[model samples]
Target: MGDFQPEAHVKGSWGLNFIALICKRSSAVFFAVSLLKSIAQMYKVFVNDKPIIFTTSFKNEEDFPVYIYKNTIIQELIYKLKVGKLNGFYIYSNNLIEDWKDFKVKFKVIIAAGGLVLNGSKKVLFIYRGNKWDLPKGRVEEGENLMEAAIREVEEECGIEKLIINKELLITYHLFIQQNEYRLKETHWYLMFSNYEGSLTPQLEEGITKAEFKNKKETIEALQNTFANIVMVYESYLDNID
Candidate 1:
């Protein structure tokens, strides 16, 4: 089978920090603080807009169903995901890191980096690929750190220059299949700015058909056809600015 990605609702670190700030000022704050920390570091994998969270903390959110990690069969969850049986779900566990390690082993993990680039007009960069609007990104290269990879990928894919990373926005995980094997892509996203007014060139070899900058209204329209993880990155950027 060719690469098939099934796509984040989390607002990233800024939202977490907001919760921590409020929790620290409350009466029964310690429990809330600890709970926040546990969830912050947990494994939250996204399928479209649905999150499969693995955590030690019990989620009382009521939006998604929760199951005990130890008692759950991973394959069953995968089946439910494929059939659209669940919007989202949680696997609660006392041992979160260990459970995450075990869970991730089921798929081949690939690390990648990307940028949400903004030019002087506050317009965002977008690429059209596989009939979907997408941001520029690619797998991390050997010996290159995530930040370096993010800059390089955007520059190469969009053929633009004079870019600077403002800060790391968030990390996203998406599952895809290639050669009949499940592969999970973990992408580190960064908020970036550029002043280059040069022509935008889409890397045709990479299947990117068009590259252009979009204003706020245009970006919103594009998001309707973009990946769920890209929405998470955009929301994270908003949080950072706010």
Candidate 2:
């Protein structure tokens, strides 16, 4: 139903030995192995708040849930993706969906809005939230619209101004356990772009650590270096660009 999108990348050389790009939504990791020489510019994709997948040879083929395939055997799979032999990642959606609620006692749903701001080429602006790479977003405040809250969250987190919400992206839902209770968070995502380029000052008071821009290549590398949500977002973006 949707076209697969190949995000534009600024190429360079940086040979990653072996990479494991973890996915968030389905608990799978779809990835490729490459002999990168040097890293030029790059784009960073953060799902929820982790880096999962990255590559220099990213292409949009047929849309497949193939990205969500997982290898049930963990040790063997990690060994393969680490030692530079496996060229592809096996994703298993059932791994997460089947036992996802076992850890939760009970949960309540909440509404939130967030922004995915892409810079030049395929570079995206992200903040180091707590210990993870994340886009700026938060809960909707009283007297504020969802979009308004989305814009406000980005500005407060990244300390930028005047973000133009381009296109709306897919909404993602997951349950979080806080204070011995489950909290359901439904996020409204937007493809937000802007012309203002300024210093990024993460709101440390709000738990943000660092703020920076990563070109597509660096961002791809971050997929292996960071967490899983990043991979899912990239795949989602690939689906979006499609």
Candidate 3:
């Protein structure tokens, strides 16, 4: 009882006081084991139930470990995670579970992607949002990295690729919860330059009805009725007459 571990259990030491001691020791060991297991689950990027890429561990609601499990089955886990009582997160791989103190993720990360392509003297791109004109951006798929998904979305939504990234824009957005559901989005924008000359192709499957190019004057006109973030960075990449 003085030094008991769940990983080490035995029969034939069936005393009442001894049982109590062993129970206490095994409790701590179980907590630690479950904690490690939770950590191991986060480092995977799942695509259709299979892992494709290994990124920093991300947490879902299922990872939070309960106390002596003080609160209840679900409530205690939720309360512990929300109040930061159980802040320890591990990044496990292969057969080792290591601590991940830096990138402690929240729950439900959704990434939206967009890119900028250049065409001749004009530097412009097209985007289509829900029933509105906007940048061609969509959610990143599981097991896909930020830039890879971004490039794919651009190619699919605009029918253009072979781009050279100028720079990656900031990932910014808001968080809101719906009825009995919670979701968070991490949108990473990019400025990519491409030399494709095919006609603009809007992804019909995604409801992208139009894809077009614009000159400086037309780009300004297009910017007037677009997403807020699109307009914010539109002028930064304008064509300069030398």
Candidate 4:
């Protein structure tokens, strides 16, 4: 966990330096094992536009710097983030799950499902809600799996039928305050396809002002006024199709 010391491959004397060489190899092996395990459980939770990444491997070459979790406090980090003291930060720990538990316990988790819909014209569907461009999604209801909920939400919110989920996309997390308590909304997204070229209807009660399919150029322009999490979903969709 200190400054990384890359394992050397030079042959050395067996009598004097054999024990030191064995110790070095052991350290390298331990690091490699920890990194692999951490990679499997990595998560990025968005607080507004800033991300709090939880992982043991400092793999991302982004501007955010990794901080050892054992030596840092979660509340302190969040406070700094709120006051604009930090743009974003990473929480690196060998015990990744335990550290994540400490962070997750801080909020009431809400699960939702939604979709990125592509039509026969190869255009993507978007909804304008809360004064920002967003994909169609809603909270998960009882007795429904993630996929069913996603399709249902898209149909109900955008008034589009005959929607077919092509594949499961990624999950995104964002925090908001509701009724004086912090809540984390976990959205499950899917890549969907629909051939319905009929009129698009935005759910009025949900405050959706527009529901329309956009071409590549229009989609790129809409991203400028959307939330960070929405951008992540669209980017993931692009990655899957490409």
Candidate 5:
């Protein structure tokens, strides 16, 4: 694990034991574990770009088929992910963390950076692209640190100047297919502030149609149409402010 440490904790619910582990793999995978007097971890396998969090406690859902296993191995799970054609599926297991750790080493990883930008009026910056509301972010360029790339991407995408990174925020992960191969993206988020009063311009070449600062109400409305990870980031920002 080369300096990689898993974050672990335990919580009790209804006299049952619950263990949570944050595994720092190529992508950060959160495991919400359940235990029978002893701690256990769950697996979140990404299939077709959607995540299916599998646990021993999960009941069958209507959308995805549930696979029950008494001794699920890592190879079988990997095969299912590579060959299966469903949106996602669940695998119930007690030793999922060990399997997940082995599964993570099979993929290529990409690191990215983005910012949650705040303006002088306390409005948050957002971009409209691909018919969805999103924050201004992109892949970190070579020779530039995460902070530098975050600030640069925000300024370039939103046509803003003098943007300052206030602090590092939470990290998020998602899977994508590029060049017919699966890859994991680890996005580093930062809280940023800017006071520019000039006209905003969205980077047209990047398919961004509009870039503007939105108030709290507008931000909430945008969240309805944004990605899950963006919603999580925005919610974290809200928690900090409150």
Candidate 6:
């Protein structure tokens, strides 16, 4: 195992303390929540685009199967999590944080940046890609800082300029497999304000089909079909503004 470094710190949507880690060899992302001291709540972490939720209680009416466990070896638990067929699982443990720290050391990490762009009219910018609504973002480039990469990606993907980064918003983490390699991506998000009034053009080369600023009603509709991370960013933005 290589040295585990803090790649990003994520403020959990459900009030869980979360940390994203990166190591040297593999690309594994871990999200661990401690529920031993409080009421049982659901905690989510995406792996290879699949959401693996950790919880304490089992609902009888759940549409998906849940694996219940008391305690297990860290290596065996990770193997089961990686190869499990179920939608989610639960583990009862008093050392949730330490267990996750051990499990996270098995992978490499990639850092990315993105923006929640709002125009002068208060509409938020969105892009359609792979038949889903998404925000403009990309991997951080060489020699570029996170802030610069975020502004550049938003400008390039949406074909808009004059993006002013208002403040740092939230950090999101997700796991993905690329070229047969498991990878973790830590995305730093920024709240941005843009005054560009030009017609929006999606970056076709990036598989983006449309880029447009959406009003409140349109945003609500779009959120119904966006990714969990995107929804988190938008909701965090809303919380700060209100």
lDDT of 1 by residue, 164-194 (tens): 9998877778887789876889898899999
On the 0 to 100 scale, the lDDT of residue 159 in model 4 is 94
lDDT of 6 by residue, 1-242 (tens): 12322222334444322211111111121222222112244334564433444444433324333444334443354445568653334544344445445445555678889999999999999999999898999999999999999999998999999899998876776666678765767788899998899898899999999999999888867765666677667766865784
Each model's lDDT comes to 0.75, 0.52, 0.48, 0.72, 0.64, 0.64
lDDT of 2 at 21: 32
> lDDT of model 6 at residue 200?
87
> What C-alpha RMSD separates each model from the true structure?
8.6, 10.7, 19.9, 13.3, 8.0, 8.8
C-alpha TM-scores of all predictions? 0.79, 0.57, 0.50, 0.78, 0.68, 0.70
Best by lDDT: 1
Candidate 3: residue 139 lDDT (0-100)? 85
Candidate with the larger lDDT of 3 and 6 = 6
Top TM-score hit: 1
Error of 2 at 148 (Å): 0.9
Give the residue spans of candidate 5 off by over 4 A: 1-49, 54-101
Tell me the lDDT of candidate 6.
0.64
Query: C-alpha displacement of 192 in model 4, angstroms?
Result: 0.5
Alpha carbon lDDT at 60, candidate 4:
44
Q: Could you give candidate 5's per-residue lDDT for residues 1-242 as a string of tens digits?
A: 02122223333352221111111221211221122112233444344334555455543344455665545453455446566554455666556655445556767867788999999899999999999899988898899888988988998899999898887766666667789876777778899998899999999999999999999778767765666567546654654563
Question: Which one wins by TM-score: 4 or 5?
Answer: 4
| Model 1 TM-score (2 dp) | 0.79
Candidate 3, position 32, lDDT: 26
lDDT score for residue 45 of model 5: 36
Q: Distance (Å) between predicted and true CA of 109, model 3?
A: 2.6
Task: Tell me how many residue pairs clash in candidate 1.
Answer: 2
Per-residue lDDT tens digits of candidate 2, residues 1-242? 12212234332222222233332222223322221112121122222332212223323322211243233443343345445444333232343323233212234656788887887555787878656677777998888887999999999888888689877775545445568644657667788877767788888899998877778776665565443443444545654674
- Model 5, poorest ten-residue lDDT window? 17-26
